[model samples]
Target: MIFETERLIVREWRDTPDDLDRVFEIYRHDEVTRWIGMEEPLKSPDEARTVMTRWQARYEKNEHKYGPWAMEIKASGIVAGTVLLGPLPEPSDGSEGRGEIEVGWHLHPDSWGHGYATEAARGALELAFGRYEVPEVYAVAYPTNERSIAVMQRLGMSPRGLTTRWYGREAQCYVTLPRQRAASN
Candidate 1:
């Protein structure tokens, strides 16, 4: 899927070497990956390639679990990070439609404070809610991940009164779209 923003174009992984390299650069950053609860900053180029291979395979295996898209800047074509809207492998509850579409994003350390994640995420959400017609979207961030939590709040996602421990870290649960108070602008 492809979605556009004023400054960035968010779409599924194309698997070009350059695209793989850009995503690896961001994923390999110790600071950035850790913020997202990734234990290992992305390693070898070959490993990145393997990931892409799997991503492509998922498109056929399960459309709900597609490849994470590379986030590219419109002006320079530089990949800033990744934006993914896919089904949660497992959901907080185990029932029908429990694994609703989830929205997630990651970016290079240099891209921080630039609103790129939020920008790309807005585009992804439009596809999730508008194109796919998902009634709601969720985002979960480690309690220690203040930056991610802040972004979730900016997207108008609110606490859903749930929590979980993931990868040995505490996480906060939040949901957005069709809120009782008001919809996002």
Candidate 2:
């Protein structure tokens, strides 16, 4: 497991059939995919496998320091969704090079409203602040994504307004430093 919270076991996603199916199940929903990635839901099992392979490659290349990870509910052993900690992309306008890290989550609709996203994100933050010593983490979401915005607020992230920095489109941005650094400032 990459990390664990009271109710979650955040871990690397395997390339097995079951894991691919779980990825499809969670990402096939337009409701969940609309706020992330291509904004189009997966159309087939082949696409799901491709997605899993891409994520797995990222995991290997980063040596697990950053990438999307599966969020498994410990009580039920069901893979809930994904939690990501990675480098935010450089500004689309070429204003700057990459230097920021981001923390984000995407959960199955069935897993929504159970506080899993928040819990899983807190676990990611702990890993970032503790093991990786990331100075700060950012989260960007569509302005209308109230649920994700709420999670950021719950994590004590400060609103940083809108930017087209990371995702190549306008996104509402929030940022937080490690607790000690935040407190000292």
Candidate 3:
């Protein structure tokens, strides 16, 4: 496992049939996919497998320092969804790299309203600030994504307003420092 919270185990995605099926189950929903990526739900098992392959490649390329990881419930051993800790894509405009890291989550709709996103994200922040010693972490979401915004607030991230920097489209940004996290606790 990459890390553990009181109720979740964050770990690497496996290549098993069950894992692939779980990946499909989570991403096939439009409700879950609307706020992330291309805003398109995976339409088939093949597409889900392809996505899993791409994520696995990213995991290998980053040497596990960063990637979208599987969030497994400790009680049922059910894979809920993904929590990502990675370098945000560079701004669309010409600029030097800022080495900005981001923390974000995407969970199945069934996992909603259960505090799992916040718990898993707290653990991801702990990994970022404690083991990785990253000075700061940011989260960006569509301006209308109130659920994610709420999670950011709960984690003590301060709003930085909107920007087209990372994903080449305007996104509401929030950032947090190690010190801010301590104060929030």
Candidate 4:
């Protein structure tokens, strides 16, 4: 496990078939994919396998406390969903990693309405700000995804208004800066 919150265990995902099957269950749910900008659920296990492989590889390639991590509830040992902290993909405008780190969460619909999303996200934000010293972290969501937007606000992010800065489509951007104390003269 990478880190542990009071109610969750965050860990790197493996590419084994059982783990792949577990992850597929989360990604293949329409309700979960809907908010993630996917119009349809992931259609096949191969598709999920590919995603799992990619995430595992990305985690291995990084030394920073970043990439997609599985959120397993401690008491029940259920894999709730995922929490991610990483550089945003290039926008349609084609700018590369202009130092924008994104924080996001995806929970199975079964896991919704619980505090899991907020708790897992708080762990990711703490890792970004407290450990890596990233100047700030951002979150972007479809304008209509109120549930996700609510999570961002609960994380103390201020809405920066609608923007096309990260994803190709227009999205609501939210940001939070690290509380670094000023140096005394």
Would you estimate the TM-scores of all the predictions?
0.86, 0.94, 0.97, 0.90
Question: In model 4, which runs have C-alpha deviations exceeding 4 angstroms?
Answer: 94-97, 180-185
lDDT of 4: 0.84
Better of 1 and 3 by lDDT: 3
Which pairs clash in the backbone of model 2?
none
lDDT of 4 by residue, 51-117 (tens): 8877877876776367798899999888899999998887766665677899999988889888998
Give the Å shift of residue 88 in candidate 3: 0.7
Comparing 3 and 4 on TM-score, the stronger one: 3
Which whole-number lDDT from 0 to 100 does residue 101 have in model 2?
Answer: 90
The whole-model C-alpha lDDT of candidate 3 against the native structure comes to: 0.91
Q: lDDT winner among the candidates?
A: 3
What TM-score does structure 4 among the candidates reach?
A: 0.90
Top-down TM-score ranking: 3, 2, 4, 1
Worst 10 residues of 3 by lDDT: 88-97
Q: Judged by TM-score relative to the true structure, which candidate is superior, 2 or 3? A: 3
Residue 183 of model 1 has an lDDT of 63
List runs of model 1 lying over 4 Å from the truth.
Answer: 64-67, 92-97, 165-169, 179-182
